[model samples]
Target: MSSRAFTAALACALLGLIASVAAAYVHYQLAVAPGYESFCDVNATLSCTQAYQSVYGRLLGVPVSVLGTGYFAGVLGLLLLGRRLDALASYLLVVALVGLAFVIYLAWATIFVLGTLCLLCLATYAAVVGLFFIAGAAASVPMIDLPSRLSRDLRRLSGSPAALVLCVLVIGATATSAAWFPADSTAAVQTPAERASQTAAQVDAEPPLTDDQKAQIRASFDQLPRLIVPADAPGASVVVVKFNDYMCPPCRQTFDLYKPIKAKWAQQAPGKVQFLTRDFPLEGECNASTPTGSHQASCEAAAAVRMARGAGKSDALEDWLFARQTSLTASIVKEGLQEVAGLSDFDARYPQVLALVKSDAALGASLGVSSTPTFFINGARIAGGMAPRIFDYLIEYELSKTAAPVPVQ
Candidate 1:
């Protein structure tokens, strides 16, 4: 039974490692590659992408999956060295217990706090739990004195130079891997100087658009069907409409990415560029197309913003909510609605407000918007976030065209 269980635990660890890798890769694709869809993003409520996009996906700036990957790999390594080690069962039990702690916390966060589920995460959790039970059941040492046995064996092993070197190597490897893992949502943000340097590197690599290229892009952009128009642009020659979700990571990134572009519009074109936003939260609570909901507060947050429109606090409302994306909850959103809009009639207005979000979502669906941060630049559709250069180029092109009228195709 002991041999069979150890074998099972090894298999579980391998499976867990694969799941961790999948989770890490999913988040990676979402960050650098726009419009990338995951097979596991079932909806807002049951999305792997949502959990990865949330703060819970990373711990202390390192991707949680990286830790998980290391953990499962360590388990396999320990088990492989089992025959050479004394009191292997005790070590396995102790290690399993340590990993179990993370599983419990992450499971709770996924269900209660983030209000989303990741299929790959669930698989990893199962593997961790299985390892705990298998190790405990197959323990050769006195199970009741696991800690004492583990401590004694660890001390014995530490006395050997070979074991000591191996321990140091493993520790160093885990730390170094975590420190160097590439992630967009690290705990420490980039300083302005760092950002500038990165921007300079990208600029040097990406050649500027020539006049002929710009003209071709313009001609093609004009021929694309215009499916959306701004609701509030009075004399604006160009309208930029975005279908955004407050809970989505890319949406927040895109919002920040557009700040400089928005600044350019204000400074150079003034009323020539008009920007608008529409709701397309991935949550099924408001979006019918989503079979399962993620982002529990998304619909409520949308309602709050809709209500804020009456008070002309919509922009402020967006800013406030987006800033708290990491910790947003339905109760928090509702409470904040009262605090910001401070409307006594917020609850009464909620149903209608939510309906407006639904309406916007329906429109987004008709326009083939499959993800958050979808854009419509004067009717030409873009399904995901764009590069900074392209965003600026399109806007500038439209501004240049404002001097003369061209009929819509």
Candidate 2:
């Protein structure tokens, strides 16, 4: 390629990098915020809020988007500055490809775990894939004389297997440290309060219930907490409070089961049932109860939920978050929430909301609720989940007690 053409190609790559990083920022903001007025909640089923709030959103302790920002910035800088900077092209190509591998992994998670698709996120994915190819093109740039350099490196590899192994290990270690060590992605770096919450949750282990016992308890409750509330109805007679993690897979399933009941009860009793959802994101970003980062983008997703809650759209946002839970990764969940819920501006006022959500998580721990989908029916606790039929049976029993009835002979 001519010098001009090469420079042009490099410019395109740099532009893509910039776009990807910006998209990553949008994704991260939506995934971490708390609310339904997010971009992902555009539709009940096609929500980014759900995907962003998932466990798959995070990698190690950092927001995946934050990592993306750094990675793309590096690539963009390399491309823009490489012609004048020594060894810039070489480093850019190698680092971009390595980063491409990680991005590919996240893309796979988006397709497989978070089932929803974000057009912007897909565009970012395309940019990464495109950059991987651009890196290949960059390798051919004249400044580095890569072919000869690689030949020598390969020759060294051919003769010294131990040296090759050591080189690979060194490269891998460097990449990992670069990704994980920056304060941005590092573990909660835990605050004292968070540390205490983590310690308390760890120490207070609740005993597991038997299957039959679990069934009996689920059967005893009339309705599970649902995210949405009925309009033009009386306040609920039985309030079921739910402490949930957006990224928690089992919680997603349990939420699905309870959703129908919420709809049914609201239709049947019209204001006799209400569901109060509190954030319990497993990511430590804003959640004091999380000991370690398990779910990737959970903190941002939780923030989105908090934001949505503030807007009086908590149920709508929570359901939307869960509905699209499969599409978002932890990185983009917060952004999805922000876009769909239209509460991007409310992010500044959410620290207290986040704290309250975290406190609710701590309360869940205090109440001896370890796993998610923990249902409290008017102060009666039902730990774990239940079968749909069992829930139906329980609801009928509760409804009968309140319903006017004829006496049996």
lDDT of each: 0.75, 0.55
Give a tens-digit lDDT track for model 2, residues 1-409: 3366346546645555565455555555554432223433433224444444455555665556555655555555445434443344465567666877886777676665544455545655666666556556655446348667656645644575655555555456436644653332112122334433433443344344556765566554435443332122245456667667776545665565556667787787776666677656655565555555345566666777777766777666666665555455654555556666776654565576667667766777766565566666566666655555555445544545565421211
The model with the greatest lDDT is 1
lDDT of 1 by residue, 128-202 (tens): 898889888877666687667667766776677766666676677768867866665322333445444544554
After superposition, candidate 2 runs with Cα above 4 Å error: 1-235, 323-331, 403-409
Query: In model 1, what are the clashing residue pairs, if there are any?
Result: 44-293, 44-294, 45-293, 45-294, 226-379
Clashes of 1: 5
